[model samples]
Target: MRCCLARRRAANSPQKTQVSLPEMKEQLSQLIQQALDALAADGRLPEATQPTIVIERTRDASHGDLASNVALTLAKAAGYKPRDLAGMICDALPASPLVSRTEVAGPGFINFFLSGDSSRAVVQRVLTEGEQFGRSNAGAGRRVQVEFVSANPTGPLHVGHGRGAAVGDSICRLLSATGWSVASEFYYNDAGAQISNLALSVQARCRGLGPDDAQWPEDGYRGDYIADVATAYLAGEKIDATDRHVAGKADPDDLDAIRDFAVAYLRREQDLDLKAFAVHFDRYFLESSLYESGEVEATVARLVANGHTYEQDGALWLRTTAFGDDKDRVMRKREGGYTYFLPDVAYHFNKWQRGFERVINEQGADHHSTVTRVRAGLQALQADIPQGWPDYVLHQMVTVMRDGSEVKLSKRAGSYVTLRDLIDEVGCDATRYFLVARAPSSQLTFDIDLALSQSNDNPVYYIQYAHARACSVRAKLAEQGWDWEQARGIAALPRLEEEQEKALIKRLDQYPEVVAGAALASEPHTVANYLRELAAEFHSYYNAHKLLVDDGELRDARIALSEAVRQVVANGLWLLGVNAPEAM
Candidate 1:
């Protein structure tokens, strides 16, 4: 079967500070629609048989700037051969200022060649838009809540958590860039068995007991950070976190005191680590608050009242199977304590009550099982919440490499590599870029040696170096006692007839579309990949031609192009939470 190509639409609302460039692909789609409409008006084609118009960029420049397969898709229904239908569609098309001409390509494909003026207009658009070049109001002020890096305060953030932070923050940035009212949240699992173990571990350490001790609490934490927490508790140190603050009682024998101090201490540590990594959360929702505020009990009561629960062998079982689970899940165990997923349902229920139309959770893959249970529990509530009301972006594990070997453990975080180690060693820019340079669904191997490299071999460096090169051109222009006027540069746009200049201009025109696509798809890596290609194009152009030429008009035009490249690179890097250095 022949595949149908999908059409692209330009964003409707553009910011006042930015000039919105028309999407050439969308313009072609509209022209195709007009042709179909004209055919329908003449009764040559049925008015009711409307096919989706698809316009795509051509693989080879000779084909055209854009191409469409609508003719091929509608040939059978239109009662015509493929190429003949293509000819009819082309013949019916109306004239447009953007598209210079159209052609019937192989197998009934319609190719569109963009006018030279239309293709080169993106440089001026880039300069006019400045920092707001790629931003669009695609979401129309919709509310979205992004919950990410929701780690328990039991320990410091590991590399896995680092990946979550980087990806989640970038997702929030993308959503904001697309004009979504985004709220970032971090869920704190500060209750349940994990906290119990953490308390016991701190208590053991406060008593001068080590992990190797026979009397050390069972299933206790073995990390040396536990010892640090214990020492802080004994010293009466004041600990402050975003949501709470506590002071150590300096009493080792008090387990409750130790637990409170330790939780606060570690939370503060995690906050510092995230701050260093340039990740921030609007709110810290604690799991313990669900029980403290009676939300968990209210959820359970509602579940029972709604006939979705039953007492089975001294335990309350939820009918998750009624919704989608393979088997029923226990809501409350025989001992009367609730399961982990119960509070999750309550938390998400709270999220719904807060008027968030869309909620996306960025979590580790380990939470895969909880996804179904949480959704099923929400369904069982019968709250009119959609079955898939909340969305998820689960990132796979990250493997850190050093000297061609897997680096598994950290001195601070006993069981896994700490996020801080990576940030401190490779710097935040490289760390953020590497963490988010790939699809979150795919496993990532972060090579420390590669990240630290300063050559073209490193993607982050290469992209940043391109921005720096553009900045250098401007500096050199100033150094040569040449004042560039925007009016002059814009007028000189006609002089940009070189192949390299045309390629760069075309690529610059696609930035807004790329931003919109990546934002809607929740794939920041798409922006990352685009930046690398864009940087390569700029670097190649810089190598082939001289920006500071003796010819006045050509020099201004080239400088204008360089400035556009710099602006776009800066804008793209800002979306990914990486720095676009003026000098690298």
Candidate 2:
């Protein structure tokens, strides 16, 4: 008995048994192809062509586990009606224990039904894999850099930054989960007009000039936080940031000193807000570094040498129109200062040189106009960068709501709702979830009350409660002097044949596919939606069934199922940078 148990343990180990939904789909496709080959061999159809076999999960349970339209795709080439071809393909399918039966449905759709054992195998796989269950190697160790929340260090991080933080970090997590070597970057525009404006704003405040004062720069920032910076600067406060440290000179006339101090100070503020939001960057890329290193000049030289640039009105302009732009864009202003487009090209070229085959820039929709210009600039460089060299994920605006009205201003940030405010009020977990649960392309409306709610009406809480409830069941079982044993649970999974149990198992089986799809499509919202659906299935099953029944086998099976759900919920929440609480 001891030897037999040891053999079973060895067989169930993660390294020994690695089954995934994608692998299952591939196996089904291979089986279908074999069937098609046999049909061609027997002269029932023309020789099989090299058609791509696509397998998708059936939406309706009555159909089967997986459905393929390979027959429909190849029927015309095979000179047979689609429905007739599907029937022949089904008849030619090789016998397999994994597939209990095959059926031909509408328009040459071949559906394969898995045996009960095959369907139930996912439970064992989940238990064995634990947190690693849904992860995949689709990315194959490709290097990708996700630059986001690259907010200029002019002020604190506002709610818009919060949205980018949530989405960008989640993208990194999803990519990492799918075997992509992802670098999370926060690019800071430390040397630009924005910094100059910030310094002027501080200087005016230090000189006792308000926004209404004629001395104040036009359209200057007027937030109360500007006064705080002015006070700190006049007091000669020292500031330290990720890239630089500076001490204020207490000289309001020293505009350069104020510029350095304000940039460092606001960078620190943005850092704090990010810390509170539970987001961190692998690197803090300073835009000033590009200029300091002469990359901007080199990039312009490349553009000019490639004949994509010309002199116009005492300024150098890139023939952006050549690369599909509406018109040419100025590369360098007549004042010898390069336009923002130059530095952007330099930064992306820097990213490309860093050996990132894939680079995703997550920014607000307001930066949409720059996308065309930047890509055109890269193409002009003749670096052989793809037409769409660095991909972009532009998120729309986020509006914060409280008391049934839009709350738009933050004293800390000067003009918008601060990210720290949301984190402080609604908490890091709820704030991240609310920000990321929707598609980034859609404008998000963050309702403060909705995020703060502790009940099921809140999606985050609802999903977390499912995990906690599962934990509670195990705690209760332990309190009664019983513990879950993997051997017994595996032995008893066959007893889980109830409708709700089957439904829960089916939902759990979809997680790996969901993770791969979300990662490949760069859509973390898919995982968020999948988690909610999984939670709903678990909740329904919990409400309809008793986990600790009189039947020992059934009880063990149910507990195993609940444990799988809890594990998955925890994994899914972790992907979104949200914690899964044991009790909430």
Candidate 3:
């Protein structure tokens, strides 16, 4: 366990420098295409033929840095064997300082060995960008919005909602790091029938002291927080007039009473819990607010103009099928009330109105049926909504377990484990990490025992330990007369050359790649897995060698290596909303 947490640094490390080259990979890809074009241009190949370069990692280190297969593609058209085509392409390659050597081997595969300068430059890039390395300008400063964990205000967030929170939050963080301006949103379900019932539930509970088995609505909330919310609502507020207790009486504004009760009750409770769980939002978009703003009316009218909606049976229906939905969907039911889908489309239109180039809705598992029509409606009204409107992400369920048994989690209308409950048990860092530790599409089983455990066996603890170890190493260095800010007088890291040291260095070099891959995939779990792997590498290095050595140069070099490690671990954990503590 101790070994898993140790973070060994290298002193007398290489001098850091920045690499500002623009689109090196893209340029390399284009050059490979040129090589294929050369085969055709030289009349040594067939007419107008183009075979793509397939560059990727090599299994054998001796093969080179990156391998490509442009030759195999040119073989058929050139009427020559693959190896012969590879030879021609290699001979015609342009000179580059980035590539020290290029060799053709194994069925016409072209392997290029990157110059040591490029590899060394990667270290500097890590130092310069800190945690923001590998972030892309692909977004080109596009404004984006992410709406997530909008679980109705009727109850506390359950286990499943935790997954959406982590996924959505991490996606927002990744996008912002990559040059996209991002806003995190929560769509409040504060104006629905279910919420109305919640107000009445509290009203009923307020009239009584304890659980009333006789009058308790079966479909209403039964969570402990329900009682808690009820208490908060009753505190210091007078309830003198009682129509229900009288002989068959009614409050004139009964529906309004219920609506008012639900909204306030949920807002207070959710606020308390959201803060406790550290699931924050920049804005809480209310469905009622959209309705009040006439955005819904505007959306419906625009849909009609687009010929996507028609009146039938005194109810408005959107021709979603025309936009690829299986069937036309009702905007308002025959009962003269809007279907759930109506406001949903209106919400997305509002997202577009806010000038977002892309909108991502991180929805729960249950909303599978609703995603299609909302997208279809947007496509139907593309003239009104900006192009490339929105993308929907449906995450699967999360199961909470303890001691190998499924914890009882019955959302009985509004009864279940709140986000706060999980936080109280495992803490915010553990909760966030556990939420994103699995694939979003795969049903996740969160082991309460594992997350809350102090043992390094827990991946979160292991990562945190690496961060803490880095800080400790730095503190000791500070006790001596060294600071990471001072440039290394030595040309480069020397004598930190054991396998373990190199292993840790390699891990540090790959941070940008890991971050870039995670953002592209829209999978934050990749970051979590990366931190764990990196921690293991650093730990192994620390345990095998003594960084605080008798030799000053080697000691300084080791500390420099550890300083780089600390920066990365701290940055990665910060992106995930996990702390990198100086001391455990």
Candidate 4:
């Protein structure tokens, strides 16, 4: 991403600023699109009007920094051959100092070789923008709400939830980094049967039953934290009731005592665990609150009033099938209990009502069925959403491994590993990176051995080490009494011809485009991949180039380049909540 550091403070946070881009690439892409459209009109090609012009780096430096495959992609439909079309498209390209030459490569791929001057200009933008590298307001004024790690307040979050935590959190950061009014929320499931079971299990434990006791439901939560919570609640309750003498009134103190103890205990566990794994939530929305406000009932009533609900078998059923659900889902079950769907709809509706134009929910793939139902409900009650509504992102599961064996995570069985346990074993940075290293849609095996492996095999540590090394270089620069602030600019940089430096700079240049593309596509995992790739480029650059040369201008230029690399690494890690330490 091209570094341009123009940023505005986040609405809710004073510590964080939202980055805005310089809009150079979008301008360039528009220009290229126009060229393609013009070429098609000249009858040199068929339908080049809407081409997927990918401006990417060519493997061969002889080709260029930004390569376009518009000509090659249109080859089949366009009567003209690939090379002929490429030539025509080349002829149609707008004249600009940014683009030095356009060449047709293997299979008629049109590659634009940009000038060093253009690359130099990007660094100047980076220096000028400071910390807003790769920022853009493409989202304009739209509000986007990202609800993630909505882990039911059942037990401590597990290693399996780590990926969703990392992915969802990173996504929110990416959206916020752009110009979206992004709100991060953690959906607390405090009302479901899950919570009821938790309360029941705590009561059972209060009666001094074993964790494996039959009184504990077969499907109840079984993590160590449950026992801890139950023990703490019981101790606090007995201690409180014994000390208080309320004649006839139910002491609100006792109720609060239990709730506060439980919430505080669990909150501490979450903070400690997430800190270990580097995930954070901006807001925690309690499910009970939604019910308390009668929003859930109101939503159901509104749906019924809209003819989007029907009564069947003495139960309220949503006509979700009308809007693409596999079948109508029960809004309220025959037992007179509302299903999770009802409250979920109301919660999201409340989010939209709170002025968020877009609501994004990231759930585990196990919630695939629920996702469908939720989307269906939203579509059935689409009238509720003024414009943009809730979008469900169902990420595949993450399985944990220890010494090459799979660790089962069944929240229902009352036996599983916690996210805290994973961090205690592998550290947070590794945990976060490993989860986000892959596409969220792809199920990943969280291999403990691979993560702990000290070799370059550990990608998270590899990236972190690169950052630490860069910082160490800066320290070295300071120790040498070199003034980093008064460093020479990129133009002062020699015809930077080192294959490694050129490659790193090229990768850096692609950052803005990747960020914009990812934000527009609503695919934040792309940013994660881009980070890993950028870090790798820096590592390669570090290993190959000697930055402390005697040539002052070149040395300063290299230092500036390294600083930019460090800035990006820190920015990426900041999004992930992973530290960019001065030393490993």
Candidate 5:
């Protein structure tokens, strides 16, 4: 995680210009478009032909700031050698202040060299924009609903659910930052066979029967938390869930009452866990509501009317195979209950009706099979919903390690490590950071020892420590009777031409691009990785240069750079649902 900013040019190098990165990319694209237009005008290329102007950042700085393969892409179509076409395009390129030079490298790739001032301007931009530096209107105010951690209200949230929550909440934050009117939702499967099993489990515990007791249901949950619920129920406890409140009855034989109380009680527990992790949902959608509102039945009738469904062996079947599923799926069994897939389709249809044209469901990898089935069901409705109507982000399971072994079970959850156990042991900040610092498709190992460590090994501590160090520098400045003058710091930015200073500024400049990329890819781990690198850059800069120098201008400039680093780290951490402790 110790990332050093790219090395700066020698002092005698050519002076750099002051263009923003986004503006520079735009200018480069426009210049290439103009070049292509000139070629077409001269009959060198077809008048009706146009290609996308794609500009990408060079992986190696020696190549240039940005590069394009337009010359190579258009060579065959334009009837010229790639190199010859590149030369023609370069010749027609418009002169602009943003471009210091342009070069054609390897197989006709055009590279643009920007002035030093272009990268240096990011410092001033960061200062001017403050917390709004990396935000953009890319989403165009579109509405997007992100549903995550839709764990059934049967038990406390486990580590897998924690991963989903961290990722889902971060996605909402990322979408909001990029101009999407985002809504976070949690779908609860409150009425189902699992719920029935939960009720039986709690009822068995209420009757003084443990998992080993003969009277316990064969498939009942054996989590110790079940016992706690049973004790509370026997004492007539009132539990307030997200949507309702229910007081448990002491009647062990009343399965209906037990089911209701168990769902409400577990939901309340989940609410507390999410609150502790700083995750908030805008909506709590219930599966039972779909059935109660007649949406499920209506969905079935629509599928039948659309010729996508038929009856087989007294069960209604949807022709999911027509939509690429391996076989037809049962919408409802002969016994009268709808299968899980039907309810999912109803939920998504309801989401579409509610005006969420874009929806993302963040769930565990175990639910991968449901993706095709649900989308196929939606397609059968002929509702004009896109083939891939609702998007999915599936995260692999998380394994918690402790004392040189995997901590497989939580005493309360029985079969898995509960999220509350993690929060209680390693704290919310570390837990969230650990869960979200990797790609969702990759399995994660949540090492408790590493997370709890205060040393550099813990990324959360390392990043937070960098922020604290920056704050300490400001405090030191005041203690020495040298107040930070905003005007002076802004004016002396150009004097911050040292290699370390330029490197830090370059890292700061990358924040906007990082945010936009992460948002577009629906990967918040990109931001997490970026923050870690930014922290490393700050720490390296701090160690190499003294902030409290005798030169007033240099001191103010360094302090300004440190402050920008602090701002970015705080902003990125906020996106991850982690607190940026000022005194970590």
Candidate 6:
């Protein structure tokens, strides 16, 4: 087992600047490389026996602060047993202030036990960095376009759309924090059979025909919101959506005018729904624009020119199997109208041409079939696009539960729960947190009762309350006629000797790594999970300790720790697009 002793620093004295976890990891990696170089120079190991060193925090405190498997990784390469190699590497390692000691454990794992001061310095670092604490420049400001919540403007957004908006927007925030220049785009499927059905439904409603009426279109939408749209249209309401403005014609007989009006009306409704949910898109690219600009046709011609397309049974098909699709897919139908996937291919091709080297599509898992077809279409174009050109984050279904049963129907939508319904019931913070608190690929169960709870059962509430508790400490200090000295608290950091204090500092140190990893993996849930865990740690520590103590040095140190906790909770919640309230 590895153990480290606290190195006492002058209480209430000025200290040097703090190093972040990534910087410390890099420094440790350099030290290991130095050891490798020494081994090479001593002729015990081959020259340039350098491997990419991976340093990870030890889950168990007994194992040490950080660990590496470099020895086990390079053991075979050096013709030495793993344990023997670890000992040799340890012997060769130079002195460093960051690591107090090194240990060769089972399977040749090299564990570095950090000095107590180094471990506790995270509190000072968190205080110094504040809101910018967890952010990093890992992306190097690369341009990344994230397309999400492109719900067809046929009806109001449903619960599934809520998940996509929350997850997708959080992803953009994550990428931006990691230094990526993120562009959030929403692709409007505004020119398809679905939109045609929406127009027919609205026109039928305008003609005083209901779903039960025999004159209703077979594929007409049955949502009560459709009736609302028709009412607004008959009123000649001038509706302005993000992309266009349409004055309702008030002509029940004009199908063309009704189509335009209905699309605009529903698009505006979707805009309101997303706005109420606190989601925004940088651009709304319309599917009709693709057809109007002839990109769809141009894409089809290119596929044919590349010989990746064929004509059979009076339809044009792309040999999607050439790019790993299960089979070929139809590009244009027998009646000359293109299929939905063709428009998708054109849209992505436009994305590539616009200089978006990285494009991520966040959509429902129901679009799984399109992933292969879309990629295959991109490949068949003979474009320089990679095999998996545009990436996709497909989220599974969301089931909203209330009072022990599934809440399936919404009065406005008349079919499924609307995103606005959830937002109105629980407010935006709880809704956003619940929607994104799980991995995208996992099925999520949103519990309305739990989200509204004031106890720890509510994750959003619990996390926010921790921040609130930390904030209350300062208020209490003020109430007691005591002021906190930040420099004194940092200098007195060595006074925080409790296991809980140590644990909280260690957790705070892991934030930047968590943010970078979550951004890279396109997993916002990782940050959500970390916030919950960190909140739990803070709550436990706060419960066991008192910040407004009589001892000035100890009080300052505890206040500093609490403030650090507050800063980190705020930072993590900000990344998830959720708020961390100073008071519950």
Best by lDDT: 6
lDDT of 1 at 225: 96
What is the C-alpha lDDT profile of model 1 across 41-115, one tens digit per residue? 899888866678877777677898788999889988889898998998899999986678989989999998877
For all candidates in order, the CA lDDT equals 0.88, 0.88, 0.72, 0.69, 0.88, 0.89
Q: What tens-digit string does per-residue lDDT give for candidate 3 at 1-584?
A: 34212212222223322433334555567777776677668877676765555677565566876778877876786788999888888887887766888999888899887665455454445565666666767677899899998877777667777788888988888878777888899887666777767766766666663344778765666665566555555453332211111111123235455445446556655666666666678887888887899987888888888777888998899998887689899998888878878888888877777888788888877888787788888888765554335777778977788999988665432445557678878998999998887778888888999998999679998998988887887787778776554244122354456656655655676677777777767888888888998899888888877776656657766776776787888888877878788989
Query: Candidate 6: where are CA atoms >4 Å away?
Result: 1-16, 33-52, 74-92, 106-108
What is the Cα root-mean-square deviation between model 4 and the actual structure?
Answer: 7.2
**CA error at residue 223 for candidate 1, angstroms:** 1.0
Weakest 10 consecutive residues of candidate 4 by summed lDDT: 3-12
TM-score of each: 0.94, 0.94, 0.85, 0.83, 0.92, 0.93
Clashes of each: 0, 0, 15, 8, 4, 0
Model 1 misplaced regions, further than 4 Å: 1-26, 37-49
Question: All candidates: CA RMSD in angstroms?
Answer: 6.2, 2.6, 6.5, 7.2, 5.1, 3.8
lDDT of residue 559 for candidate 6? 92
Better of 1 and 6 by lDDT: 6
How many backbone clashes are present in model 1?
0
Q: After the best TM-score superposition of candidate 3, give how far the Cα of residue 101 lies from its true spot, in angstroms.
A: 3.8
Candidate 5: 10-residue stretch with minimal lDDT = 1-10
Give the Å error, residue 292, model 6: 1.6
Cα deviation at 121, candidate 6, in Å, is 2.7
Q: What is the lDDT of residue 535 in candidate 4?
A: 84
lDDT of candidate 6 over 349-467, digit per residue (tens): 99999999899999999989999999988988887899788999999999999999999899999889999998999999999999998999999999999988877678898898999
- Candidate 2 on 59-79: residue-level lDDT in tens? 888888899998888888888
Instruction: Give candidate 5's whole-model lDDT.
Output: 0.88
